[model samples]
Target: MTLTFAEAGEQDIPDLTRVMTRAFDDESRTYRGLDKGGPEGYDNGDFFRQWMLGYDETTGYTILLDGEVVGGLIVWIIPGGHNHLGAIFVDPAVQDRGIGTQAWQFVERTYPGAKSWRLETPAWSLKNHAFYERKCGFTKIDETDSPDGVMFVYRKIIHPD
Candidate 1:
């Protein structure tokens, strides 16, 4: 399918929430396993909506597939450093179809002068780590954890020359 990347506006919040709910629901199932009976604590549509809408407008992009809202990435440009790719998710049904990769490449091409791109994923998500490293060209830089949880941070330097 032909996917398009566009600047997301406040009006797109609802559709974005729906897509995220569906995507994260699949992830919750993957991590929690089927024996949980029904969806556990991870299905937080309200939280996703709040987070997505809370993003600063100047640094985010939403993805549309075949003119339907599908996914997005919230990029934050740190004041004195690299760009941070805060979130990127596609509909679970569309995963492994290169939509995420294309969306990422679109971000890079759109912002040609960025010094580097950074992102963090849960340490437990091995599939995500492999995808970011092998497909998106990111390398694990460091990791951190607290009583809260652990996350692996990855970075890819983008040279303008």
Candidate 2:
């Protein structure tokens, strides 16, 4: 499947919410160690809509597949260092299909001067950790707790010339 990256605007919030809800639903379940149906609930798109709308545009990027939003990345440039990938998400159904990797590659190419790119994933998400380490070239620099109680942190340096 072909994936396309785009700069999302206010109009795309509905689709973004749909994809994020599905992706985060599973994430919340896994972090809580609960079955598909559990007390630890997940946030819907409204939550992300509010949060993302508040972010400055220069650092935010979104990806679409076949003209539909399937993923997004929120980044920020820190004063003394490289940009941080604050959040990246792919639609649950479309994950493991290289959409995320391509999106990251897009970011790297878009910001070549960045000394490093940092992001965090759930400590228990072995799949994600391995993907980042082996495929994305990220390293484990530290660990921290999620507000919901999960723990892990990782970083990767996007090579510079």
Candidate 3:
């Protein structure tokens, strides 16, 4: 699938909410070992509200497949030319088609000056672990235990010459 990204705006909130909800529901269900509501007992609306409340348009992008919004990501370009992948999600229906990998490629090209990229994911999700390590060239840097669950931090150092 052809993938592109557009800057996320207030107008995209509803679509982003749906996409995020659909994309993460399975993980959320598997995460808590039951269909509680979301990854951490919160529903889609909770996630949407948090995103809307804390969103930064300058660092948010809606992932589009052939011009249709399919996913979204948030990245923070921090000081010292480093960056963080605040979040990235692809519609579960269209996953395993290399869209996430391509999205990361797009991000790398878009932020050519970035010296490194970092993100965190649920430690129980081995699929995510492999994707970040194998496909995205990230390394497991650390792990943290939180009230929600264990999270593994992944980091990829960019070598741009």
Candidate 4:
């Protein structure tokens, strides 16, 4: 399966937001019995536009499989190669196809300067916990409470040869 990560444009916001909502809502229903869940402003794409694409040190992209848009990703590059994965998600309709793993490999290749990476998933997202810890090779470092929910912090340190 081929994958592409194109830098997001203003026009992509609406669809990306839809993908985000769908991905999050799926997990919420499975894990929490709720119909809605995600980072703030995802309901209307405001978070994607204002923070994911607009903030300093942040870069957002649209994940394309073959030629169709499937998801979105955001990254933050800070000084000292201490980077952060702001978010990454594939549409629920096409999930479990290894797209997320492929996208993560693409992310690592894209950010060759990164010496470490960090991200957070909601405490209740068991699938996310496994994906990050088992598939992505990140270790749970801590947990913190946010307005959205309790979040588990995960980190991976890249060792150079």
Candidate 5:
């Protein structure tokens, strides 16, 4: 039951890709009624590897459960406290157990200077919508039609007290 975040590296690409693929596939199967989904290279290590080590303006972490890679998260830390949450995916087998929430908390704590966090998700992903809006306090700022489907953009603002 121990959960941790480690700086991701090239060695983690395989595990991260596998977990990301599983999460995407689960979403497709459950929500989209499709056999598979996710953007290009979603299931491949090439995409996962890009974020694993050092990608432009991005900081990535591998979510570990009992020292095993179970998920991955990436954030684009733009200047001026305006940042973007690129992605966060956990193994479908371990979904809904607060791991994703913990990972999010980690982001906030690790970057106290962040004034806002923005991200986009597919409109059909009700599970993701709940997690970001309900659990993480993100507000839907915009919704746009994309080639894939309707896309929802969310933002969580931090007011310095």
Candidate 6:
């Protein structure tokens, strides 16, 4: 399938909400300790969008597969040469298919001036840990437990020449 990154806009909220909510369904269930259903859920795009508004240097993109939205991401460019990966999610139905990897590569190339990359993920997400550490070349620098769950902070330094 052809994968592409499309700039996300305000009108894309419903689609983003649908894709990301489904994308994070498994993680939400795991975090909430619910096998069937629960109150607290994941992929609250409205909440995420509100949070992103606090960042001055953020960009959002929708992951499109064959012209269909399958996932989305938000990135913040730090002034001093660092790039923070605010969020990245692929539809759970389409996970493990390398769509996220390609999308990330596109982001990296799109922001070539970034000297480092930083992001955080839930400690409970073993698959995410593996993907970030192995496939994405990030190192888990630290992890801290919160009321919700443990958050793992990862970092990757881009080679400087």
Give me the candidate number with maximum TM-score: 4
Candidate 1 stretches with Cα past 4 Å from truth are 34-58, 146-148
Candidate 6: C-alpha lDDT: 0.78
Deviation in Å, model 2, residue 31 alpha carbon: 5.9
lDDT of 2 by residue, 8-66 (tens): 66677677666766777676576556544211322444545545566563355668889
Error of 2 at 50 (Å): 5.4
Which ranges of candidate 6 are over 4 A from the true structure?
30-44
**lDDT (tens digit, per residue) of candidate 1 on 1-161:** 77998877667667776777777667657875632211122244444344445555335567988998889777776654577887888888788889988988898888777888888877766777878999899999999884435779999998732
Error of 2 at 152 (Å): 1.6
lDDT, model 1, position 18: 73
Which RMSD does model 3 reach against the true structure?
2.8
TM-score of each: 0.82, 0.81, 0.85, 0.95, 0.94, 0.88
lDDT of each: 0.73, 0.70, 0.78, 0.89, 0.89, 0.78
The 10 consecutive residues of candidate 4 with the worst lDDT sum are: 47-56
Clashing pairs in 2: none
For candidate 3, the per-residue lDDT at 139 reads: 95
Q: Please report, as a residue range, the 10-residue window in candidate 1 with the lowest summed lDDT.
A: 34-43
Q: What is the lDDT of residue 149 in candidate 4?
A: 84
TM-score, model 3 to reference = 0.85
- Alpha-carbon runs more than 4 Å astray in model 3: 30-32, 36-58
Candidate order by lDDT, decreasing, is 5, 4, 6, 3, 1, 2
Which runs of model 4 end up more than 4 angstroms from their true locations? none
For model 2, what is the alpha-carbon lDDT of residue 108? 82
For model 3, give the 10-residue run with minimal summed lDDT.
Answer: 36-45
